[model samples]
Target: MFAPIRWLILALQFATILPTPSVRTATERDIRCSVVWFPVIGMLLGVLLWVFQSFFVHHMPSLAASVVSLSIYTLATGALHLDGLMDTADAMGSRRPREAALEIMKDSRVGAMGVVVCLFAILGKWSAIASISPDHWEPFVVVPMMSRLGMIWSMVVAPSARSQGLGALFARKIPRWTVAVATCLCGAVCGLVLPFQQCLWVLLYAILTVTLFTGWMVHRFGGTTGDTYGALNEIMEWVGWYVFLCASA
Candidate 1:
């Protein structure tokens, strides 16, 4: 029996630092099926972030609170996505041929471009969080949730750049219908927290951002990899925050 709960647990364990009950056995199918639960994990993360931001904003200065909250956010995910972003940046920055660039990405050392982009991403998130009005809790929840949904979209639609690695397995194994299921679930949650029109717009932007980014990656690397998926998540999160900010304004 392929229990949905078990898949959800797999997703949580794969995507976050949060502890979960161990699943004694897991198959490639189980890992692939877990993609459906990614948005749910993002929603949970958003809830935690919203709650943390609400608490910290009252006790500390907005800038300081933003730093602390961002730190917690990064720590919670074990900086998994950020690591991907850096590796992707390093690969792209090399501007080498496709194979060489991928080699660069696989390298363990962080390059200069990687460090710079990482700093920018963190600073951008911090500034955006600090700027968001404490009364507006929607961005916190919507951004993270939508970003994870973006990952599913990328994995489902984009071919893997290589024959091996987690990205290839997910790309090869994920069911197409999972896209609709994940999108609807994410949409329903967004609708609950955001105005209908705004939710629709945010979803629209998410689709555009993910599609365009995936296309760009394909153009560069012949397809996407695990690093690209992480890179997309980080990029989409920033885009989501900005979209929400503009929508609220």
Candidate 2:
């Protein structure tokens, strides 16, 4: 059900743009495609990075290069996931009931715990990209794609932890087919950019890890909330780096 693949990108951006409002505007059928469009966004961002890397990471020393690259790549999204990661971390710190955790997540206040997790996740991505051999641009182009897929994984496996929330609408409307298609599309992109062995390994590890992690969250939370989904995306991508570390072109 690649219905309106073109609109998939629009729907994805729409979720970020109109957010909760989009659910009211679009039919339920459009919901899953919204999540599916994430990798496409990542792919577009990756292409931009691929195009500009020489002007940034290539010319700079490794540490400086990583910082420059992360800034360019993440600033495009205004560090959206980073914000989610931070909020999720703060929420996790609540150590209370689900309602309390979500309340903390929604608070505008940024706590030290949130900042620490955000900083570490950001630095981890930078370090992974920095340590990667300069000749391998595949990881550069593909990791973002995989990272977005991680978001979808959270949406797919976990039920909404709460009723009448963002995660609930997403979980209610998103289709299983969209997940399958997104996975295949992601596989195709990775195949184009990576050798068979490397692509297979990274994908296998990513899929297994995401699946297991999503399952754990589902069991623990009895479903997923918006914050948990955000947390899942950040965690999965950080793990993706270590998984890919074993693979090569």
Candidate 3:
């Protein structure tokens, strides 16, 4: 649990605007902990986001919450995941060979396809969250947890599309067994935190979404990359929220 902290703190500084301690040199163990603990931070962010938004529910509309959520999300990681999401769309747009796809992803400029995809992702997520009433607070909380957990799970299991990339860095060190532990822990947390019936549905949806993403990744880009993981995070959050809330309804 403590192992990821040193590495995580450094990563977090890049992804979020947190008041972190001075950037310290990290060991491989620290890197391992980064992969493990980074997702946990996402979970914590879920809870904090919900609490913050919920506190203002009476004073603000759903759109306001969405804006706040989006703001917090962008500010949290400085849109690190979102950048990955865009890079992935550009790669997919190419529909070229694996090397071409990877090369296209590396280009700093965002392409037209990438722009539309990212806009859709943000608006899709915002609309989904914005439409929900405060009555579905649990789903809001669970959705973020599931999405982030799914990202972590993908990192553990999915092969990196390129030999040299951020996904490769994390995926390289992730033990195969870590996937099972993280999946179970995510389920256990949801079970303990969510309404009983909703718990089952949410976990199932998360697992299903994770599986579907794995398939899409392997089939389309040949394997996983940081961009795919980010897109997966956004997609699965919507899936989890939709299913969990619908089940509750």
> Each candidate's TM vs. the true structure?
0.97, 0.84, 0.87
Query: Which of the numbered candidates is closest to the native, going by highest lDDT?
Result: 1
lDDT of 3 by residue, 68-135 (tens): 86677666767777788788889889889878888888888899989998898888777766767766
| Per-candidate clash tally | 0, 1, 3
Residue 237 displacement (Å), model 3: 1.4
RMSD of 2: 3.7
Q: Quick one: ranking by lDDT, best first?
A: 1, 3, 2
Which is superior by lDDT, 1 or 2? 1
Worst 10 residues of 1 by lDDT: 171-180
Q: Per-residue lDDT tens digits of candidate 2, residues 185-225?
A: 99888887778888877777677867876776566556776
Worst 10 residues of 3 by lDDT: 29-38
Clashing pairs in 2: 161-224
Q: lDDT, candidate 1, residue 162?
A: 93
Estimate the Cα RMSD of every predicted model relative to the unseen true structure: 1.2, 3.7, 2.5
Name the lDDT value of residue 4 in candidate 3.
Answer: 48
CA deviation > 4 Å runs, candidate 3: 1-4, 7-11
